[model samples]
Target: MASIVDEDNKKLYIFDEFFRKGMLNNELAQMIKDKGYSKEVIIADSAERKSIDEIKKLGVPRIKPAKKGHGSIMTGIQKVNQYEIIVHPNCTNIQDELDNYSYKKDKVTGEYLNSPIDSYNHGLDALRMSIQSVKRKARILTVKL
Candidate 1:
């Protein structure tokens, strides 16, 4: 997800995306360069440190590891949820993820858990990583009827 942030208004305008599976580091580097993001500071998943290093070496500048740890996912979810996210019409995958991402459900009583389901979150994870330093007080999500 490529975005422009409106910090004062707490808005995240996601304007572009490249969502493809099994892409190699070189391909990713080329994408960043082709998309004109060579100079931008990109926050990538820390889990892919080796890949990030390879991309950096491949000539895309300022690739930083995402800040992550225990409860980080939920924290990021809350942080992003506070903002009004505006997605580009062309970014269908992002729109789909935002619309479908949800909390997990309990089996026995069918209660919705606070934890978020892992599915449909790749783009969202990138978005969350992008704004790791930006903070917002978390609000508990209540399901709507």
Candidate 2:
């Protein structure tokens, strides 16, 4: 958290919302008050890169190489066992099916469509890694009806 601090001579404290156990660094939050420094906080994740230009306008130093599947992926099953509502577009049963994009072809000429396939299913792999890593066996699932 100190690494992200912008200015000098003024002290700042930072804290992670959930994973980091301890008190919030009110000094930094306070310093913004003490010196009247503008405070900017960023909440970022794996999918935020697409909005790079928009995020930069907020005036806070950016945290980069944003992490995915933090608490949820690494400990989601242990934290909240079971899963529901998996959604994926262009998904296929086998990895190779994903590799081939369901073998889409130009209907008119039967020529290869040649759309890049591997990129389509990567998000699902990311989700699978997170859920399976938790290794929870409880069948109870909480849902909104």
Best by TM-score: 1
Identify the runs in model 2 with alpha carbons over 4 angstroms from their true place: 1-43, 69-72, 75-145
**Clashing residue pairs found in predicted model 1:** none
Tens digit of per-residue lDDT, candidate 2, span 90-117:
2223233324333357889988654423
Q: Single out the weakest 10-residue window by summed lDDT for candidate 1.
A: 136-145
| lDDT against the true structure, each candidate | 0.75, 0.30
- Across residues 1-47, which tens digit of lDDT does each residue of candidate 1 receive? 67777777888887888877777888888888888887776778888
Score residue 1 of candidate 2 by CA lDDT: 15
Against the true structure, what is each candidate's TM-score?
A: 0.89, 0.22
Q: Positional deviation of 109 in candidate 1, in angstroms?
A: 2.3
The alpha-carbon lDDT assigned to residue 123 of candidate 2 equals 32
RMSD to the hidden true structure, all candidates: 6.7, 18.0
